[model samples]
Target chain A: MRWNYLIAGATAAIVGSTSGHATTYMTPAQARVAMFPSAASFIDRNVVLTPQQRSVVQKIAGIPVRAPKIMAWEAVDAAGKRLGWVIVDRVLGKHEFVTFALALDAGGAIKGIEVLDYRETYGDQIRNLKWRAQFTGKRHGATLQLDKDIKNISGATLSCRHVTDGVKRLLATYDAVLSDHG
Target chain B: MVLSDCLPPMMPSFQIMGELERRCRPLLGTFVEITAPHEKAIAAGFATIVKVQSLLSAHDPVSELSAVNRLGHRRSVTVDPWTAEVLQRALFWAEASCGAFDPTLGGLMAARGLLARNDSLLPLDPQANWRDVHVTNREVWLDRPLRLDLGGIAKGFAVDCAIDAMRAVGVQCGLVNAGGDIKGFGPEAWPVTIAMPGSREPLAMVELQNAALATSAGHDASGGLDMRHLAGASPAIASVTVEAASAMDTDALTKILVSATLKSVVCLGLAGASALTIFVDGRVIPFELKEPTA
Candidate 1:
């Protein structure tokens, strides 16, 4: 099984991304609207947390904050009211990683999660809307552990754990970086 | 609505490039990526994928396929036009591949716990092959107790459906790649890399000019040796990639090549289609590209 994984991983690395590999499941603009259909506008921002801020994010998210720099978008309505934040993040699966977006409301609660691109043959159960709905309404400081809080799919255990961990990290980033500010 | 103007001066306006947009969603047990020039075309592409998924998903209990599998063995069940069309194509391949690409393996797969059960009836009949599957007047009947699984073929057909949708929306050039099964339509020839089995780099790159490509590896879904019937066909080949005029044909051809002996591989060539086989020992064999003699 392990040997097969290595081969699968290697094969996926090649086939998943080649010259014509810019296969996007949803563009940032589309995802922003899907997560917040009534949003009047969006503001894109590139963030690189300070060492102190990174430490704070790590403490809150309970996961190591690797690459403290990220690009996040803020979606707002026509009335200038903030709708939510859309952050695209990638997490490694059994073979290749899945690119996804974690949408959060102004209060740091999850609004929705959308898978952007998945390269693995298995462990795709994470893309189910029912599976993603579990994270809705979850806020920072919530215990976002797999099996305990998030239900694990029978075949997609690795993706389940890793995505759960990724969500925790994103929530922690929100609490540390975007929670109090606009 | 000029929503951008409503934002405060502090918020920067985002400029969306109206170039080709690709979006992926989970469907057909894998991520289906649809690309188009505009949002409307993209939406249509996805609608096609969703439509096929809802109609054909063997695991989705509410799918039309589940209904057919649940009751077709007992009585002839009429299916949607789309279902009938896909089933017809599946039967064509089942015959073309000589049971090598059998949809009747649903029972065997389910018994092995590879697929979720659609009904309590098990396809235990060894004689239950594609020959026993009867289709007429958009209705289907199985002579024996075997469930049909279109997993190997439906996905490719879905890609074709998406391409058709894209064309319907007036998109000139775009491609839909569901996992590794790809179909490039319109003007541009999309470039693709055929990844070697268990390697992180391309074994070969080809310019896909309005063509369809499908690959099958020796490793199963669980990343273990695939003991499927292909083992008896060619045990040395680790992976097989086939390019044909349509995704549906490429999808079925890969299965035939994966399980075919080298001599049989040479005999299965069809015009406008070609195949390349990679062995576990790193040997690469490209089959003669010629039309099949019916």
Candidate 2:
């Protein structure tokens, strides 16, 4: 029922982020200067999580602790098993909103993923159950090709591209974090 | 006091739906008119439905059939006459449809995790297997305990019962429509319309005089699991309707018609019902009623 302190903090940073209680939000400046500086400009870009989404996540987290609004996530699985927890971040893109989640297993494999939320209207139907299922057994070595590796729904091309791109970027961020922590 | 004891009157017609549901819980389609509506015949007619429903339900705590279905891999079990009879017809339909109209599909539906619990919470794993359900006289045993989902066929059976109940009431003309599958017995001739599977517009209508008509369309508003029952099917077709002598015949025939070539339409006539098959293309294949046998 209780997680270790480090996992709890990371989980709180990821899961309880943007929850009801008001705390210091990672401003564009703070997010740009402090975290993922390589992708700061991209990470600190426009990000909006609907209250409905925040509510759903809060209910799922079942935690009442206060935490800052985070735009970058890094979930850790201390004991490699099932999907431990997911880290989500809203990265602004050239055309649309790109919210993505990075799921880590106990052994640091990307157990599951979600293009958590996206607004690339065209050809994005891939994420709606059919497309999300493709990443079920995906690991770090899984190819991230938009055209060949990931199949896009015909009508939602923009969405398919954005998701595949977001996944690749999240993996880059995960790699940078893992090397640092290790 | 009798009909009122078991059911509330939703309409002035015979309580066909109530009868089927009470008799067969986990029943697929419980609301289809088998009996014609007469103000005076309501009591006698509805009472028959109630009795039948009680006989069909698998709710008894210690019923031999329920035990087999709930706890399978059994040797043998004794079945009541009515349950045995219904199972007999179901077996016949399963064979006739060449596995299209299977009562054994409940297990498969459960395994698909398609079953919604009584509390409406979906099970973590609900992949059903038809092989799990085993049927023998008096015993509805299974290879394993899997969830049973009776979606299409149950509605058809209820409609058939409604038709019989209407005939017993001495009312000559009646129509029983469960969700969508309909069966009618017109005093002279019943004019039935077949709707285009997806579109609300009427594609074609016919007069069913001396027999029953059942229409099955694989069409769903959302179109979830259509071609799942077919061999190498991709759920491309919209809906398929078949007219048969009995509602069960029509219900089971629809599945066969979807996979069948033009050659199979003749077998519909052999099964004893006039044929009017419609596809998503708007082409209608019509057949006259067949010569009666068994």
Candidate 3:
């Protein structure tokens, strides 16, 4: 392995600039149309969780409820037939924020999910101790520049665990409130 | 002046960039993002990825790869042409790397609990290697009972397939990124940033033009060198990144470079790829392939 490492000074020059920018993949309206193309229209059916409903959602989801309000819409065909529901939610990580839309059939089964926007932000103080513990052996915690031009990232695959967890919580929200609202 | 008048007039000497459409969806146990000039092109690219995932995923019990592992020892099983193509390419790498990049490490992966065991299949053969598996046209069979995992290479193949799908739709420029196995082709270069292992810190930046780049790293959580996909080799480096013409080659090459030998160097040369090994101490080393003697 040592013989293979002939140090070359050909590494690409690092651009020095820092700007916080979120990559918006889709909007809620676009996502609604994309997830349910056949639906004629969407009806706003946003919900605000009561204290009891929040507790129920937390119990069912196995994750805490960060917000009481949830943005959602009901997709109906031309003849007033219910196509499905679209729920928009956001998952906040220590360094990332992911806003996504989840679509479910009338029976609450997941139809599809589309990420609306993904933002990675760095703070002065890292809050997640457990996540930080993974890199305790590093000599330095290098500061990353969240540049808009750098669109692609290559490295150890970042786990979408937060989004997965967020999906589970949204499902619980559906069971707790949206399921019996008809 | 007369000769200049014969040429077509220059229209501002500026090109209008197309409106890029981007979308991300959860697929293949990860987020698959596709960016193209049109919505239809992006949709087609994603559909191709979804198809590849359905055909090649080892986590799905009904996937063609799972079927091959479950019953290939009993009888030859025919798979989709896409699956066959991926399998043939995998076998080629397995031979080129001299078992260094074997696909038959699924048994070990299952034993390590990295892969779920399918109870319906017979007990795994401890000595099973790539040699035990044979591919004849679209039919595949195993000489002994052994699992097959395409987790390392399938994601890259999916990215490549998605690129092909977008190109088929007359898309001249596009990018498909499946959990960091990135491939982009356009009139201009795509800038990519490499993140440090276990953290979101940018380690290096590389510009990709009509090529793919893949990075494989260990997840020891202690910043130690430990990879789950390696069968019997102990990799000294923390991460390996390969840039090649195709995502599939780059993906497989990253694994082969984990414990690269002189033979692997020749293999890299043959594949027209270059590699960079980043140490645990944050040192990035590029491979220097010496030309063979006449």
Say which candidate scores most in TM-score: 3
lDDT of 1 by residue, A33-93 (tens): 8888889888986578899988988888888876777768888999989888998777775
Candidate 1 lDDT, B37-134, residue by residue in tens: 77688778878888998999887888888887777878998888888888887787777666777777777777667677654665457778888888
Q: After superposition, how far is residue B204 of candidate 2 from its true place, in Å?
A: 0.9
The runs of at least 3 residues in candidate 3 whose Cα sits more than 4 Å from the true structure, single-residue gaps closed, are: A1-22, A49-68, A92-95, A106-109, A121-145, A180-182, B1-18, B219-226, B232-235, B288-294
Candidate 2 falls in which docking quality class? incorrect
The better-scoring model by DockQ among 1 and 3 is 3
Worst 10 residues of 3 chain A by lDDT: A1-10
lDDT assessment of candidate 1: 0.64
The per-residue C-alpha lDDT of model 3 at residue B29 equals 69
Task: Residues A153-177, candidate 3: write the lDDT tens digits.
Answer: 7877655768889999999999888
In candidate 1, position A86 carries an lDDT of 92
Error of 1 at A103 (Å): 7.4
Stretches of model 1 off by over 4 angstroms after superposition: A1-30, A34-37, A41-90, A102-114, A117-182, B1-18, B122-124, B218-233, B261-272, B290-294
Write the number of the candidate with greater DockQ, choosing between 1 and 2. 1
Alpha-carbon DockQ of candidate 1 = 0.06
